[model samples]
Target: MSDWMVTQTPLPRRRPRALSPLREHLRDTFWFAPTAAMVGVFVVWLVAQELDAALVRSLRDDGDFDTLADLLRFADDAKTVVSAVGSAMMTFIGVVFSISLVAVQMASGQFTPRVVRLFVRSRITKATFAVFLATFVLTLLVLTSYDSGADPLVVASAPLVQSVLTLVMVALSLLLFVMYVNTTLRLMRVSHVIARIAAESFRVAALMPLPAQDGQAPALGPVTAWVAHEGQAGVLRDVHIARLVRVARKHGVVLRTVPRTGDFLVPGTPVLAVHGGQAPPRRALRYALSVGVERTFHQDLAFGLRQLSDIALRALSSAVNDPTTAVQALDRVVQILATLSRRPLDAVVHRDRRGTVRLVQPVPGWTELVDLGFTEIRACAARTPQVTRRMLAGLDDLLLLAPPDRREPLLRHRALLRQAVERSAPSPADRAFGLQPDRQGIG
Candidate 1:
């Protein structure tokens, strides 16, 4: 089935050179620029001092001719020692600066607050500091034997120090790289959580049985067996029925049960036949609602906002033919979108005057329609500001497909939905439901 299909799209390539110049400059300057500048300055000063010393020695030209050769050899040896020390110091500084810069950026407001809290509470910071300090102390010990008098110690310790420092640097680098990857994964997981919640909310709002004032049961149209198992006759307990009853009560549904034990039932055979109600509550809705009120509210709000946003955009496009007006509508649209930005979207069932029930857009099953609506809105926003006849047709199609029972609730909540739609269209990060440029013309 189409519902089970997973369409994989290639990820967008990274465009490092295409990034804004200012952003690129900031990234380069934050960690590397300072260290590079300091190192360059130090090297230039050292080189100038060495050149002056050599010039003075040449000018003196003492009677002891071997003095020049000894001074030359001493200078060469001193350069080697200084180079080694400088290299180690530069490596250490680079590592420290990189870590600090990355950590600070991660702590910034770019990610969810939960992610920031998780990273801040991590013990890796302390562990990293300890590793750095140990590396520093070991490097200092190795450099201590650089005196000429300790020739044997310097010769033996030099290679050992180099080897140890190299290994330490490699290990530290790997550790930092791993930490960065872990932080990225954590942020991704947090984003997924929000997306999943938003998706599920929309699904619930589109699929759940509509609320009714009259306690009438809905007819069981086609009961697809989601799960089937034969158990003991006593398995059908009062508790199970009570739970179903509670769900019915919440949705203003009435249930009548004719007790049957271990009876063979077909797909369309209603276990406890319902009547005078909207759609029957599915297991998913029950589970979602069971979580808690806050979650339910979040889910419902998100779904509602998404639906309203799509509807409003479609309506606005059909009404206005001008691009400027369409974009202007977005400003009004933003108000409705805001209410749903942080909330979850859920299904809300409604029955029509014709006594037929159908699911609406902004729900999981109506993904295709929602996508179409999103495309229409984006097109209108980009190309025309005025609503058009075509946009109205799209809105009409959406309204026509919605369950008839929802008319009253919708009319009653028209203002609410309008406000939400105006406020809740997709933002930059929440563009999963937005139109894709490539797919725009196709739809």
Candidate 2:
């Protein structure tokens, strides 16, 4: 089977990236890993300073010196080279910092703004920055130790040793700079960006339970109270299902989310329904749910799909008029929809460790997921033959490859696509060709 064919099959549900909101935010930040690396560099430089000083003193004291003297470069030469390298490192670090910011901006503008988080959290960017900064620091510290007078007690070896290390780091930094540029370039491509988003959607799909299960959902009683949100208005990014379930079970009540992930949660809106009269503190429930200014893919599987679809829609717009980009986006969207087809599509019910359902959270059904993946692209492709043909082919491909349970949704979407093409095509022949389920849009 091909990659998508294999991917279309559902796997066992996997754990969520963050059981809570704090961890999720922490995962997206820029400085955490690089800061730790910078600290390590600082400590290493400190230790190396002492070692360099000790080596200098020992070599000077040995005085059996011709070999020792020749082995070490002059203090002035060492200082000059290290200083020059330090300036270069500083300049490069500035360039890297600027380039990173530009890359983030480009990614945000070209792809979805959510992708900015990916660039910021990139390890390569952080490592490259850390390496350059470390070299600068090492050189600066060694420059202070450059003493020309042979005090015998005073060791000039520290500068020489530090210079050698600085040279090695300079070479390493040069190599890493090439790799960093390549990574940045790859991130800019729409194909790679779409593929990455599709892969992430699959990974997140594993976080939810399969749509069909033998176990029944817990009985949801009349809403005893409505738990209103108490923060700045924003999108409900994700709900900690396990924690919500635990909280509900602990209080012997049932809870159902009023708004799903990606839904806007206003400050005074009822975010959840509490049954059995007793409700947990608004703070506790709020903590269990993450509210952010924008949606993220951590729990909202549909957000990634929406982003790719939006990209395709824009590409197909009259302003962009890039049907090829639209086709590229649709290709991944089809695979992503196929992958979601095998995953559980119904509302997710969270059961406790003993398997008693306590919380019911809704997700997009098969029809909704299919609409999200194809509706915009299909609409935008109405006037473009190549894109229209690809959309038809994508639907047909899914119809053939997706499992039986997923076929109904694909069929519905395929029907929608035919109707759209029939209505929007410029002529009778174009409409007829567009409605066909062939790759080239010919009847």
Candidate 3:
């Protein structure tokens, strides 16, 4: 979800802030949410302490000795319960997350390392850790307030509210634990993981505006200057597109990013090619491009396709020859390519108010995306009749939806699939079956 780009300003005249690389980093990590939760639990513990003291004072003053005695016993019982829950909670946290990490690791091995991002981004996993740790902390604070004085009345400054609150926290932690288990289990399933990847891809696609039917924009004069990257080497994750557009308009220049999103960058790599005029300040242009250790779906449109293909490739590998799983991955790939067939996937062109091109952000075109999605799978699945048949069907379906201009890649891939099958299949029967389009591969 952190991949959700910052919403761009509707009116170009208003300047929008650049996307913060730190925000993306935090969203990809696991620490911030649990740390905040513990702080919140500490505050709640303070409030419960005050409320418990207040209730004790009110009861003692009313000379309700009998009720106070019962309250004292209840507080003692609650303390024991809270202590047990608190001590057990840390072990529970360790066990749950340990199992979760193993599950995530196994999945990464079975599918692709990219899928580890899906597990890391899970909100349920974070919430479970937060609440479970918060409960443990709450119990520790509540137990510290318990007095061992022989004077019953004095000791009756009972942690009544704190005890009750701790019990409620314990209950909530149990509930989240159940939900976390369910979510973790779902993450392990191939079908579920494939569906999640597809869903995220579709979500990113939805954010892209349909291409303009017709438009003419001012052309760039020529390359005026080039801006080299001056940061830690990493993947070019996302660009602050709105901010680049604003900077370009302000300087009366055309700014073109040299590297597309998802490209690996070392320091001094040409990141931006300024056109029409000299480059903007290096700092100004630097922050507009967000570089990170790995790629994300937020700005890299091809990443989803890449991930799907990776899954299929892994499935078809000799180490794990599961053509059925490869077929399933193709199912989603077909859907994604079909959706893309209708949309304009040319380089994302940004224009100024006067309809002059200001920023040209390069992205994968239809041909490149189609090739990225199919080429590797086609080669790897060359002899697997199930995957070959399914791929043929998927390409056929895409051909029907593809515009005339976009059909070339599909037709080329179809031809390649047949050649691959013919070369790899052991006999004439297998070759014929492999070439035949089967929506379900074999069934």
Candidate 4:
């Protein structure tokens, strides 16, 4: 019944493989969505141009302009108006960007540097930018439709419709700019950033659910050759296990990886080793591995934990000393850890066609993960009673519903917290209070 309840159902069998770093990188970058919008708007502009021309030709043939005495004509004056609006829109865009960047920089300084990625990857911000740029682009393109020097009677002039559409675009851009400013301000708050990160982490945990481990990590005895990482160093975000299995099968050898996902692999670092046969072409093996500028949730599930933990540590540091933030981060960690408790961990035993074990890629187990999530923050915040008490409460909460396998580690971490409070609290009463499970201190 507790919020940290760890009881969970085993996940369905997953056919896991490496996520393409390039694909994920592009998705997170600022340009991808706007670039797509640009292409889409260009197509719309072309279609709108043709439709406007057709409307003008039809109106002229049917004497509609004569019938309407109040109709605004496409003239040199209209072109001048649109040109001015386009120039003004560009200027406003510059202002919006400048202000937004300042806000983002301030957030990074006050909150966490990684928080900036949220603003950069925001769909609303990207859409707002796209709308502003699209409107500017549309205004400029429609200017070419002007026939201020040519006779309206002979030229295909559709000034009234184009000008109206441009005005609509301007209105839409203004609305979007307002929305961007509001979103930017809302995201500046630390609570919103942490909540967003927590939400994303839970989504990732639920989507790429792990299964329970059957046993200890499988052993790959006597690898014949060690294969180091190639090229520039980055996080070894993912490795193609299927390819490794195939390589193992082809060589009648065993392949063993040196590090886990989320681990950095420097160039010339030993990443893999081939046993019982000649090593597979390092290039062929390297192609199956994905290295990225930083970690991602697609494969490095622990990276989310790491990011939140980093935020907590920074908040608890001497400079910031915000224990409330650390507690918030700890609770979110509990939420995901609870989710993981019910699911399985990645402990692979890849087999060849003959069903013989060919490769062993061991992912971090539950205990390793508990260490990853709590160890650093616990050390950093041992003296912060709010955080220590919250950690105790989190541990006790998870222990209640932790699966039979997880209870031990949860108890182990909880005891470590008790020891920390005992060692750091200034007095007996303070230690007693810090060890209490309630959010309120000394209660």
Compared with the true structure, all predictions reach lDDT values of: 0.36, 0.74, 0.83, 0.73
- For candidate 4, lDDT tens digit of each residue in 181-235? 8888788877778788877766655555232244333445566788877767888
After superposition of all CA atoms, the RMSD between model 4 and the true structure is 5.3
Q: Show where candidate 4 strays beyond 4 Å.
A: 1-21, 63-81, 159-161, 209-227, 238-258, 272-287, 346-361, 439-443
- List, residue by residue over 7-36, the lDDT tens digit for candidate 1: 222223431222332332233233344344
How many collisions between residues are there in candidate 4? 5
* TM per candidate: 0.24, 0.83, 0.89, 0.81
How many residue-pair clashes does candidate 1 contain?
A: 50
By summed lDDT, the worst window of 10 consecutive residues in model 1 runs over 288-297
Model 1 alpha-carbon miss at residue 119, Å: 3.6
lDDT of 4 at 223: 60
lDDT of 2 by residue, 180-281 (tens): 999888888878887778877877777775432443434576889888888788888888777898889888888888887899977888888888867887
**Best candidate, TM-score:** 3
Q: Who wins the lDDT comparison?
A: 3
Q: Kindly provide the TM-score of model 4 when superposed on the true structure, using C-alpha atoms.
A: 0.81
**Which parts of model 2 have CA positions greater than 4 angstroms off?**
1-20, 53-77, 101-114, 154-165, 210-215, 240-246, 282-286, 401-409, 439-443
